[model samples]
Target chain A: MSDQTYVTSDPRGSITQLATPSRLEYFFTAGTSLSKNLRGYQRGQFIGQRCPVCSKVYVPSRGSCPVDGVALTEEVELKNTGTVTTFCVVNVPFAGQSIKIPYIAGQILLDGANLSFMGLIQECELEEVRMGMRVEAVWVDKEDLVPSLASVKYFRPTGEPDAAYETYQEYL
Target chain B: MSESPEIFTSPHVLEFPYSRSTGPVIGSFLTALRDGVLIGIKGTGGKVIFPPTEYDPDTAEETSGIVNVGPGAVVTSWGWVNQPLKQHPLQHPFAWALIQPDGADTAMLHVVDAGSESAMATGMRVTAIFRPADERIGAMADLIAFVPEEAK
Candidate 1:
C-alpha cells in the first residue's frame, strides 16, 4: 500500500477561492436550421430535408446536401415506427445523468426517413436490446415541454417483425 | 514499408467553463472564506470539512457549522511543478499539495514554497503565507503560498 499523500497551504491564514472567466464558441450557421428541425421532433413529429439534386432525404438535414453538396429544400414528415440499426449499453454513471446505469442508447431509422437518429431504449433488459428490433418514441409529460432533445423520453420496443440484416444494411 | 507521414501545428486555442452551482451550504462557506475567516462544515459522521462542501460525502446530506479551521496546516500530499501552466498561481517552480489545516477534518488544495520535490514530503508541517492586506482578494491567491515553519 502507498503511504504518500499530498498537501498545500494558503499564504493567508485561510484561502480565498478564485473564479475564472467562461469561454465562448461558435459553429457553422447551418446549425441553426438543424436545431429547428430537432425542436419539431420533440412535439412527437418526424421531419427531414429533401435533396434537390439526388432526391435523397436527410433527417436532421444539414446545410449542404451530402452527395451533391447542394442545399436541401422541401421539409417532409416521416413515420414514427422504425428499426433499431445499432446500439450500446451505458453501464457507467455520469455526474448529471437522470437515468440509472446499465441503460441502452441506440440509433433508429424511421420508416420513411432516409437518416437515423440516436435515442435511448428502455422497457426492456440490456441483453434483450438487439439490432433491427422495432421501436417507437416515448414522450415526456406535457408540462415538461421544451425546445430541446429531452422532449421525447426514450424508444421502447414495438414488438413488430424483426427487419432482415440486408433490408437496412446501408443505414448501418 | 510506406513512407511515414509528418504533421506540424502551432498551439491551438482551447476554452471551456468549469460551471459549478454552489449549493446553499457551500455558498455560505465561500462567503465566509471571502471575509478572511476559515470555516468548516461539521458532518454527521463527526468530521469537520474545511472549504465546506454542500453535501456530506458519507451521508450525502446538507452539512452545517461555521468552525474556524486554521491559522496553519500540514502538507498531506504534494507535487513539484517546475514548468507552470498559463493559469497556474505561480510562474516559477513550486509545490502543490492537499493540506490538512488545524481543526479541519478534510484537506484543501494550495501551493507551497518548497523549491523542489527533494525538499517536500508527506507530513511536512507548513504555515499559511498571506498576501499584502491591500492586495487581498476573495480567492485562494490571497494566501500567496504555504511556507515551511521554521525548525525549533
Candidate 2:
C-alpha cells in the first residue's frame, strides 16, 4: 500500500555497498594445563612445552608435537630473550590495526625454545629490526597482565649484537 | 602429564580483511534498501521473499518479478532482547521480529524498535524506519528498524 518502489533511477548512491559490520567473541576451554602455561606470561615468566621425543621447546605450547605426532607432555621454564629468525616490516594500515606504520612483526625463537612463534617488534626502527637480532619481551605492567600474549606488549632490541647467522640459520 | 594442570584460555579474535560482490538479484535488493525502498521477489506459488533472493527459497527455482512490500507490516513472531548486543540493529532494548510486510505473503526477519518488551506482540503493526536520508549508505542498515505503527 506504500509508494516505495523496487527501483530508483536516482544516481545518488553507490551500487556496491558495505554490509553491516559484525564481530565475534568466544573464549573456549583450552584445558587447565594450557591455561597454566599462558597464565605464566601474566606473572612475568615464560614457559614452553618440551617435546620428549625431540627435546624441542615450544612456547605457548601446541598441546602436542606437530612434528613428532605425539602428545608433548612436559613443561619447562623459558627465558624471555630470543633471536628474531625472520620478520616482515608492516607498512599497510588496517581497520583495527594497533601497530604504527613501518613496524616489524617477527618470528622469535626464545632462548630455550626450538619452535618459533610470531609477535610484534617495537621500540626500534624498522631498518634496525633484523634477522638474528637478539630481542627481549617488553611486557605490559604485571598489573595489566592477563593470561594472554597481550601481556607482552611487543619485543624490542636488547642491544646485544646480532647473533651469528650460523646460530639461527637453521630456523630460517 | 597425567594430572591436569591449569590450562588457560584467552580470547583470540581473528579479523580477516575481505570484500566481496553480491550477484545481481541480491545486489538489487541491497541497492533498494539504500534508496529507502523495500523490495521482494515473487517466488514459487506466488509467495514473496522479502530482502529478495536470486532463487526461490523452497524449490531453488529462478524467479523474476520484483515488488514493493513494506514501510508497514505486522509482526508474525517476536522475542525480546533484554540486553541488546553490538550486532543488534538497535543499541537499546528491542524485540527481534519476523515481520510480513504489507503486500507480501511471507515474513522476513528484522528488528522492531518498540521501547519495551511490554509494547511487542504477535500481529502487532510496525512501520519501517529508514536510516536518516543524508546518512544512508546502500546496505541493509539503510532500513534500520521498524517501530510500533501508531508511534510512527
Best by lDDT: 2
Chain A TM per prediction:
0.78, 0.84
After TM-score superposition, the amount by which residue B19's alpha carbon in candidate 2 deviates from its true location, in angstroms, is 6.3
Local distance difference test scores for all models: 0.71, 0.80
lDDT of 2 by residue, A18-136 (tens): 44334466766767556757778768888778888988887778678888988877888888899999999888887877766878889998897887889899889878888899999
lDDT of 1 by residue, B1-152 (tens): 01112211123344653646444555455444455556677777668887777667889876655577776788999888989977789888988899888999888888988766777889988887666656655455666788777631
Q: What is the C-alpha interface RMSD of model 1?
A: 12.1
Candidate 1: where is the Cα deviation over 4 Å? A1-32, B1-140, B143-152
Using TM-score, give the best candidate's number.
Answer: 2
Give the TM-score, chain B only, in order for the candidates.
Answer: 0.77, 0.88
| Docking outcome class, model 1 | incorrect
- Indicate the DockQ of the complex predicted as candidate 1: 0.06
Q: What's the TM-score of each model vs. the native?
A: 0.49, 0.63
